[model samples]
Target: MAMGIHKFSKRRGRGARAPMAEINVTPLVDVMLVLLVIFMVTAPLMKAGIPITLPDSRAKPLDQTPKQVTITMNAEGRVFLDDDELSPGELAERVGSLPRGADGAMPLVTLRADKALEYGRVVGVMGELNRAGITAISLVTVAGGAPAETAKKP
Candidate 1:
């Protein structure tokens, strides 16, 4: 009886050690996949900027797409045109020189500004555009709510 029991115990021990030696990789793979998805989703939002709180305004959406010249305003009041890194004076001159289309309509101007920037700087840029004879201007904004229309006083 002792000899028979010893043989049976050895057989069970062999299979038990084999399973322990074989690495269980499923848990490790699951963790790596989860981290990859988290990085992919969050990476873009990280690159945009530090967030800012914007003042509420009621403004109308633009009707049509036109040739756009982008102007950016930083909090310090420095301005940029299409990433050309121009001063306000240069912005006026360059915008004034941009030729009209064959239809004689002025090129559309778009302004992107940090929300922390002063309101006066934005108005100054629009004022410059008006002085440059570019009457059609559009402010680019991310849609957070339903668009609002401002009644213009003629």
Candidate 2:
């Protein structure tokens, strides 16, 4: 009877395997970390603007506007509205079509012009904005005291 009982216990131990109830969270954690890294790298690039060498300014930064429209002009005299290249006329039309804020105020137009661009070109872009009834225009520039070597001279 002892020999038979020993054999039965051995068989039960060998054949009966219990399923794991704990979930493997390592892979899930790994995937989530990868996604976080991707988003962290891309968030700054997602801002609506074109690449340009902004001039330096000693003036204080303006208060954050509730609504904004970004317009960029590169050194080659090409105009861009939120990354979409457009002619002066198209720029006016696009600005005109923008929805107003709750206070019935037009969106503030922020102009970013390359340092190398001719002054006349920047004024011309501003003129276009004015013609479109966009009076609240702001010029973007690097704050003063920044390293001069980092600035790209136009």
Candidate 3:
């Protein structure tokens, strides 16, 4: 009888251990890492710029600067500032209204125009920007024409 009671008490004691209160963070961390990777893969695709066929140029790309404004013109000769459509007058007004930097310098501007646009039309836009006191301008173009060395290689 004594032995039976002792065995029963031991079994009860074995089952009495407090249920594990600690959480396993390993699985949680793995799920978080997977979500982070998924976001990283899709984030860049979300920043799609306005569509336009830029002219070709061999000039090297400019170093992107901070506080820069992008101006885009589609094949229809419509002007867009940072993806928002604006009239010629509105463009000038909005650009001229931008706050100057600490050094009193206007923000750098990048212009991307469709190759199908007329020369005078593009120049007219440039003139508008120049009149707005935005001289620090960069033209966006795609790479065209193989380099002399690469052409000779064939």
lDDT per residue (tens digit) for residues 1-154 in model 1: 6656555556754463334457789999999999999999998687334233333445555554567677777666677777667854787788899888889877788777777787887888898888989887778665555456669999
**lDDT of prediction 3:** 0.84
**Which model scores highest in TM-score?**
2
Q: Estimate, for each residue in 1-154, the C-alpha lDDT of model 3 and write its tens digit.
A: 6555555455554684447788899999999999999999999667447788777778887776788899899999999999799975788888999988999999889989998999999889998999898886788887664444444554
Poorest 10 consecutive residues of model 2 by lDDT? 3-12
Estimate, for each residue in 1-154, the C-alpha lDDT of model 2 and write its tens digit. 6555555455555565556799999999999999999999999678645677789887788777668778999889899887789965798888888999888889888898999998998998899899889987889887774645666789
lDDT of 2 at 123: 93
Q: Which 10-residue window of candidate 3 scores lowest in summed lDDT?
A: 145-154
- Show where candidate 3 strays beyond 4 Å: 1-9, 55-64, 142-154
Cα TM-score per model: 0.53, 0.70, 0.69
By lDDT, the better pick of 1 and 2 is 2
What lDDT does candidate 1 reach at residue 88?
Answer: 44
Better of 1 and 3 by lDDT: 3
